[model samples]
Target: MSEPFYITTAISYPNGKPHIGHAYESIATDAIARFQRMAGRDVFFQTGTDEHGLKMAQTARDRGITPVALAEEMSGHFQTMANELNISCDRFIRTSEPAHHAASQALWKAMEANGDLYLDRYEGWYSVRDEAFYDEKELVEGENGEKLSPQGTPVTWTAEESWFFKLSEYQDRLLALYNEQPDFIRPESRRNEVMRFVEGGLADLSISRTSFDWGVKVPDSDGHVMYVWVDALTNYLTGLGYPEDTEAFRKYWPADFHIIGKDIVRFHAVYWPAFLMSAGISLPKHVFGHGFLLNRGEKMSKSLGNVADPLELAERFGVDQLRYFLLSEVTFGNDGSYSAEAIVARCNADLANSFGNLAQRTLSFIAKNLEGRLPSRAAVQPVDTELLETVRNATAIELPRLMNDLAISQAIESWIKAVFACNQYIDAQAPWTLRKTDPERMEAVLGTLFIAIRDLAIAIQPVVPTAAGKLLDILGMGADQRDLAALTAKGWYEELGNSGFTLAAPTPIFPRLEVPAED
Candidate 1:
């Protein structure tokens, strides 16, 4: 049997609409999921919205809507964003859904049974803005000398009666688990931070709030509601058919990866696993906390008026262009900036000029010169062997490595390098010139180019889906005929070993951008 792979992105907070940061996380996870599917894993990918929170209540009040109505509307926005971004989530699970609520309640029952949950008055510094409690020592003075919470979220001290989780009781066990499974948290840096925080000693966590009625209610509690993170985190299992149905749970539980942003690493790496263990549930295989996307050296924030509307950016630049920009701009686990200049430059350099240009030039030549049919080859030259090896080597080595590590940029760089080599071979062979002087030699050259272009489209389909699909269409390759798994599973030194190109009226996959002159 093939290995099973389950992946999820942290559900977005439904307090507001989607932004570039949300798109960045979803797209990154989607790309990895798609790659794993192509590599022949039985893959399950989940993404959704966190609809139950104090922030949801405030947003509802401001909009003059009930919290449930507001959550429904905000959840719709998240769905639209995922669709526009081409995020291929297998299941979009909302925390407010019946299945999710049931799963969460079941887990709560389990924890209760295990003597891990109890009712107590929580009187500490709580930040509704952050949906988190802050210790006095964690506060620091902002540039304006106002005290800022650990995440720089401004906070006010409040006392409330709430239920608490016995996080302090499991510190040593959590540390021991971390020691036994070092790969549980990712990027090494994030893991070190989580361990240090856990080792410093943990306090019992406030697990329910009485300040808002917009969240899940604690069983038999009059005013208190379950904490949003605790409720929200359970959706991973809910989406896998937990509690009521165990088939999907049996098949895909213990998620292979939980892909999330650096901002929420602690919650995912620490709180989540502890919650599962206390409830007698198995932990996820890995938690990879990636870096943030910054704008002008500041974290993108709505209050700062610096939110990058992904839809607006998609309107200005195409969706495929936006997808390419996000993956290519940064190493998978590092923070990076977003600039229009950078996006346009990468579009022109990598997509339009490099990969797209190779297809257009090759196909256009065949359409005009060889009556739009793939050239039949009867011989192999040293150059053909070299170029084919480049294509095969790229798919075999770099593609799997990137997908395994969730390093989208590195995988794309490896594929683009092959396309660059193919373009260079086209120039060196001078297929256009040979068409007139040595027609047979030109046929062989075009045949080789067709083979490279076919492999390029199949190899790159995971990263830029639409663009790669269009490339396949231009080559007259049937949409469903490409075998991506076979491509990646082969040996590096071996060629794709077949050509199935029939040229059609070709159009540019990604058109070049022309800068407007200063007025």
Candidate 2:
């Protein structure tokens, strides 16, 4: 059996419609999952709505609906966004599912049995927006005289009888874990920040709330519900069929990756591991906290009224086009700015002018000049040998290494260089002109270009699945030829054209966008 690689995105909070930020996480994680599957791993990718929280209850109450009803409505938007993006997630685990409730309670009982859970009064300033508590020292006074959490979420003073986790006792242990696993939190900056926060000492975290009844009820407790983070994080386990599914739990447990936003890194890196430690369960291998996406260089906010809907963006630009830009433009683990102009410019330059143009020009020549039949090549020339070697290095080595590092931008850049090399080869060799004077040489050049396009299409499938799949279809590639793992089989390169493909008239897959003039 192949190695199992389990990955998950932080479940979306189903308090509102899906936005660009939510889509960004899904796309990035989906790319990882897709790549792993193609790389011959048994991959399980899970993402879904986090439906249990005070914010969900309040929002539902204001709208005169039950919290579950609100979750159903808003979660549909996220589900739609996932479908529109062609996300290849294995499961979308909702926190409200009975399986999730059972798994979460099992976790609570495990921690309680470990003697790390206790009943106590939680008295402090709580941020409803963040669903977190803040110490007096962690609070910043607002200019308008309101008390705010360090993250600037307004906090309300509250004292409630709650169940507490012995988070403080694990402070040194968490620091030790960070020391042992240097890549546990990712993007050195985020990891360093987590280390610093943990080094500052920790406080016991409130795990259950009596103030809200909209969440998973605490086992053997009176009118208390498990905190949102506990219920939300448990979805990862629920997606794996935990507790009763020990066989599967053993197979897919110790998740390989947990992809989450930077805003929630502390929760995953600190509290999550601590909970797992107390429960005698293995911690996830790594948690990557990616930076936020900004709209036009400014944060997306309600007051600005500029939160872009991801579906609208996908609708305006092609779905694959947007996926390409998001992965290629944003340096993984660093903040990236998005704008209409930037999106258009990137699509035109990278997709339309460079990649799409290359494929169109090559395939069109073969379609028109060669009569829809792939040509057989003569003995490889020195130039053709060099070009093929370069492409082989890119498709088999450099791109894979960059992807393994999660250096998404770097990987895309490396692939672009190899792809653009095909364009340069066609230009220098002048295959169109060769068709008249040197028909034999023209066949060799076109043959080499064909190989380049095939491999490039295969390499880019993880990032732009729809577009790359279209490219393969135009070249008459079969399902067997497109499996990424098949690239490494013996005779894979030599036999690339052994079965031979009949060509179709190639059309441009990515078109240049015409932006509306600003008023």
Output the lDDT of residue 423, model 2: 77
TM-score of decoy 2: 0.97
Candidate 1, RMSD to the unseen true structure:
2.7
Give per-residue lDDT, candidate 1, residue 267: 87
Worst 10 residues of 1 by lDDT: 489-498
User: How would you encode candidate 2's per-residue C-alpha lDDT over 1-519 as one tens digit per residue?
Assistant: 989999999999978898899999999999988888878888989999999989999999999999989988998888999999999998987888898999999999999999998998989889999998888989998999988998898999999999999999999999999999999989899999999999988999998888779999999998999999998888888888887756767788889999999999999999999999998989999999999999989999998998999998898888988898899999999999898788889888888998899899999988888886676677469999798788878877888888888998898899889877877888999988888989999988988888788888888899999999999888776787776655555555445456565687888899997564750
What TM-score, computed on C-alpha atoms, does each candidate reach? 0.95, 0.97
lDDT of 1 by residue, 233-280 (tens): 999999988886577889898999999988788888889988999998
Query: Which regions of candidate 1 fall more than 4 Å away from where they truly are?
Result: 488-501, 514-519
How far is 184's C-alpha from truth in model 1 (Å)?
1.1
lDDT against the true structure, each candidate: 0.84, 0.88
Q: Stretches of candidate 2 above 4 Å error?
A: 488-500
